[model samples]
Target: MPKKVDHDERRRHIAEAVLRVAGRDGLDGATLRDVAVEAGISLGSVQHYFRNKDEMLRYVVGYLGEQVTARIVAGMRDHAAPGPVRSFLLSMAAEMLPLDDRRRAERRAGQAFTARAVDVPELGEALRYGDRWLHGRVAELIGRGGRDGELRPELDAEREAVVLLAMIEGLATDILLGMRDPGEATETVRYHLDRLTPQGS
Candidate 1:
């Protein structure tokens, strides 16, 4: 009898391998052959899962977005009250940083796809829509914070949402470049978060 293969598990393994190769070796090195080797599967098996490079790339893009969303939702669920608006904001923002190996690899893969998406319209659409969803979540959090008196009353939720997202992306970019420490960036973001709230309010 032959060993039964878990197709979904194999696909996930290939996706993870894609991340690793893209992270350590750059996107150009993450060829189908390389991913197949990294995933410990035959080239035919990989082809069986992904019809072509474009399909595989699309899947990887979705995988990274799903990973980030799942992390943010988990963090929100774990917090008893989601704490202050600043706390929720910080927690959600930290999901983008390369604070752990898994996140680091994801960040790398995300950056690679972002650059490639310039010429790939579908990938560009996915990124744009994903970013919009993220911004909506952040804006909602900001609105809640203002109502609870945990944030500055004069702060514009939509504008602050964009700013927060930019800051988080900048921090992640620096981390990916190895020019900034994740810990330091996290602290810096916290400082900015603090400034958004009044001492007594």
Candidate 2:
């Protein structure tokens, strides 16, 4: 009898291999053949799941996004005891930073995809969707903070959300380039959050 294969699991395995290759050598280095080698699978096996590099890349990017979202959700649950909205936002920001090896690899892969997305309309659209979703969520949180009196009464949630997102992205890039310390990057986030929600109105 032939063994049964879990198609979803196999695809996830391949996605992990893609991440490892892309993370180490950038998107250019993550050829299907190289990914198969990294995954310990046959080239045919990878092709069975991904018709081409673009298809595989799109899947991997979406997979990485799901992983990050899950981590943020888990962090939110852990901090459910919430005192201030700033703490909640800080927790969410922490998940976005590459503070450890696994996250560092993930960030590298994501950055690689982002660069490639410039020429790939599908990839660009997918990334735009993610950015809009994140922006909306962050803006909502900021708006909530304002209403709850946690943030400045005059704060413009929509504008502040964009600033915060840009700050986090800039900090992540610096951390990845070794130009900034992770701890200090986090402290920088906290500092900004403090300014947004000052000790007293």
Candidate 3:
């Protein structure tokens, strides 16, 4: 009997290989041949999963977005208590920054895909979808924090959510640009979180 192939798993593997090739070479360099090489498979195998380069790029783009969303959902699972909410949020934000080589490579690949999406506006919609979902979650968290007395009484949850998202994205960009180290950038957010917490917290 022949071994059963997991087509979905194989597709995911190809998508990840695309990111690896994109990281090592620029996004444009992640050709089917390069991806096959990175994936340790034949070009025919990758082609079986992705019809062409555009389809591969789109797959990788959605894959990265799904990965980030999964992380966020996992991080939010256990951090429900008011006292731990802010710290938990910080940790979640940290996941977005590149603190290690693997994550840095992934981050670079994601940025490249996102940037390329500008020319293809439909591709950019995936990113915007993620942003909108994340922004809503953050705003809800901020509102919860206020009711719990973790945040200032007067802070506007929607406005602060936007600001926090901007800061987190900016800090992540700085890390990509080598303008800030991950540790310091993380601590900087911690400092701000401390200020946001009530005097006793």
Candidate 4:
């Protein structure tokens, strides 16, 4: 009998290759043939999973979002007990930043996709879905903090969540462009979180 192939695993492997190629080169450089080379597979194999480059690009964007979500979930698991809302918010922000090689690669690929989305409505819709999901999640967290009295009573959770997301994205861009240090960006996130919560709480 022939060995059973894990098609999902193969797709994930190809997506990872796309990320590496896009990070090292640019989005334009991550063509089907180039991704096949990077993935150590035949062009036919990549085409077997994705009909074309656009399809593969869309899959990779979803893959990257999943990776980031997994990171945040893993971070939450590290905390033995329920922590402060600010701590959770900070953790989420940290996961989004390019503080290490893996995250840096992710950031690079993400930036490339963001630019490409400007010309591709399908890609733009996919990217927008991820953004909306994140915004809603952050707003939910902020609302919980407000209810718990951890955050200022006068704050609007939804609006603040938008601001926080914008700040994190701006910081990530700066870090990616070498305009900001990782440590400093992290401190900036923490400082912002501190300002949201009451001193004693």
TM-score of each: 0.93, 0.94, 0.93, 0.94
The candidate that achieves the highest lDDT relative to the unseen native structure: 4
Taken over the whole model, the C-alpha lDDT of each candidate is 0.86, 0.88, 0.83, 0.89
Pairs clashing within candidate 4: none
Winner by lDDT between candidate 2 and candidate 1: 2
lDDT of 4 by residue, 153-185 (tens): 778999999999999999999998889999999
Ranking by lDDT: 4, 2, 1, 3
Winner on TM-score between 3 and 4 is 4
Each candidate's clash count: 0, 0, 0, 0
lDDT per residue (tens digit) for residues 16-116 in model 1: 99999998877888888999999898999899999888788888888879878988888767653745778877888788888888888888888889999
Backbone clashes (count) for model 4: 0
Cα TM-score of candidate 1: 0.93
lDDT of model 3 at residue 57?
85
lDDT of 3 at 161: 81
Candidate 3 per-residue lDDT, tens place, 27-53, comes to 988989988999999999999888988
